[model samples]
Target: MNSLALKGNPGDGERMAIMSGRHQAFGLWGLLLLIVMAHGCAPGGSTEVGPRAPVPPVSAVGLAPDEPLRVVATTSIVADVVRNVGGDAIALTQLMPLGADPHAFESTPQDAGVISDAHVVFINGVGLEVFMDRLLASAGGNTPVVTVSDGIRLLAFAGEHADDEALADEDHGEDDPHVWFDPNNVKVWVANIESALSELDPDRATTYRENAQAYLAELDALDGWIREAVTVIPEDRRGLVIDHSVFTYFAHAYGFEQVGTITTGGSTLSQPSAREMAALQEAIVDHGVRAIFVSTTVNPRMAEQLARDTGIQVVPIYTGSLSDASGPAGTYLAFMRYDVGRIVEALR
Candidate 1:
């Protein structure tokens, strides 16, 4: 069409210009609206998801005939319990390497691949696996996960600032994750593992049950042994000073008091302030703590310094991960035995 003629009243021309400008503005706004709608096609047409939601727990599904149930465990400790229950019926992959600190674990692309291929993943869940959310996202977010510590009650961090039960958060972030320190908790782990395996491979349910029963018996025996062994330490001298709050369950189960921790909180990822260190040193002297128990996975620089400052020994224990099969703490059972024996010797 020909352009509209401008030979009109001046006022009329000005009005037409205003109308044309309005049309252009409306066109721009319409284009922007379409772009926003395109991007906002998520549920409820909301574009922003804010923070990522935690990976939800998935249920295990039974495998086909004679097919091995593929399993991935977050740590070597968790893998050992699953190994005890699943036996030879499942193909297991442990994500964190041996002796790696679980609180500071970083997942790799290969770990994501291993997780993605698994039928079920086992974890010592109470905010223990810090890399789990991103790792699960990388693994397509659909892998079944069994938290071995599900049924057992979690102990919260008895920080200097708060009481134990008072520190329990809605997310249980302050709760302790080192439940395997107590053999009874490991019995719960064995039961959870057996149930998950039985659901995943029902044909071998009998075998899983049998293995779980045997392991439970072993755990009971270990529990009895720990009770008897801790008796060697005089009641008045049973105070524990550790690198961090990793031994709450151990203390609670074995009648020892966690006199002090170098780190201020449950996580070793946290740093101890100068004030906190001074206070811990004072507590050590006040409580007559004999040694500073440190985890093999954690750096002993601070613990060594603390030991020097306090004139006590630094006892290295396995907390986060297990050692190789040839090592002293290769298995969970052996790990507890080694740690307890060291604790007894240090405190007795």
Candidate 2:
């Protein structure tokens, strides 16, 4: 992955000169450089010479006539949100593949290429993308990286999650990154995405705003549906036992307590000690948690073992990434519905 910064105000002649020099030094690699350079030279391309420029609104940036804005999202879930806002106005690429765990995802060279060519990048930022710093370093460019969770109230790690070794190892501070668990929070994401997309392609500002408004309505409906579905389960039985602290936002929003987890942290990469497992099992039995919700992105062996020991069912849920096109939880809306329905079925 090339780590060259591509955000300068170079004229076309200077760009051609740079491309020619690159071609002489590196063969086909220079062609890739040229493509990236061409993207940077597009309308709204960074024109600053030294220090990074303040992030400009999409309206401030100019796009070439008929040129689609180039965008990149760190995960499938984020990609879907951007897709809803940008619609066909932007060429978007998802860095993480479907079903990839965002917590532990490492960007490939191809991903770096995509990021390098992007005019803007969207992420679920609350320390969720552990590889983000390194990935950004590798895909060095002045592409504005937007954190969709920017203004949403963040939930701090508490209770049993406070002592998690993985959270400590990753230095995730106190805030949880699984904000998408609540549709209301995703509404915040939709607004941020629309704002960024409009800033990048102001000509499509109306279109982006319209798309965001429609998606926000869908998210509102999803929130109400989740509330209604959750009510079927008795309040006392609304405890959630999961593979990780992935449901903190969901539990908070839908009036459920996150009783315990197979792993001790917010990330699936965390492993539980024997003491942790014993404690989790005890909590499961004591709290009468009927199901252990396991994420499709993580190995379910530990969760299955816990369920077997506790005599409870192991329910699979989508987290970190969306299901493939042929799967039930393919889109963000479908993913939430599927997971909420599963939760209702398990405890109701």
Decoy 1 TM-score against native: 0.81
Candidate 1 off by > 4 Å: 1-64, 159-173
How well is each residue in 1-348 modelled by candidate 2, as lDDT tens digits? 111122222111011000011112323233433333211113232212333334322334667889999989888999998999889988988888998877656678877778778888887877677566556667774566787887889886433545555445654445667899999999998988887777667888899999999999999999998988888899899889888778889999989999887654445544454555666677788888899998998777777767887899999999889999799999999999999999998999
Which candidate achieves the best TM-score against the true structure?
A: 1
- List clashing residue pairs in candidate 2: 57-199, 58-199, 58-200
Error of 2 at 205 (Å): 0.5
Assess every candidate by TM-score.
0.81, 0.80
State the weakest 10-residue window (summed lDDT) of model 2.
13-22
Tens digit per residue, CA lDDT, model 1, 96-140: 899788876778898989988888888887767756766777889
- Candidate 2 contains a number of clashing pairs equal to 3
- Please state every model's RMSD to the true fold in angstroms: 20.6, 15.1
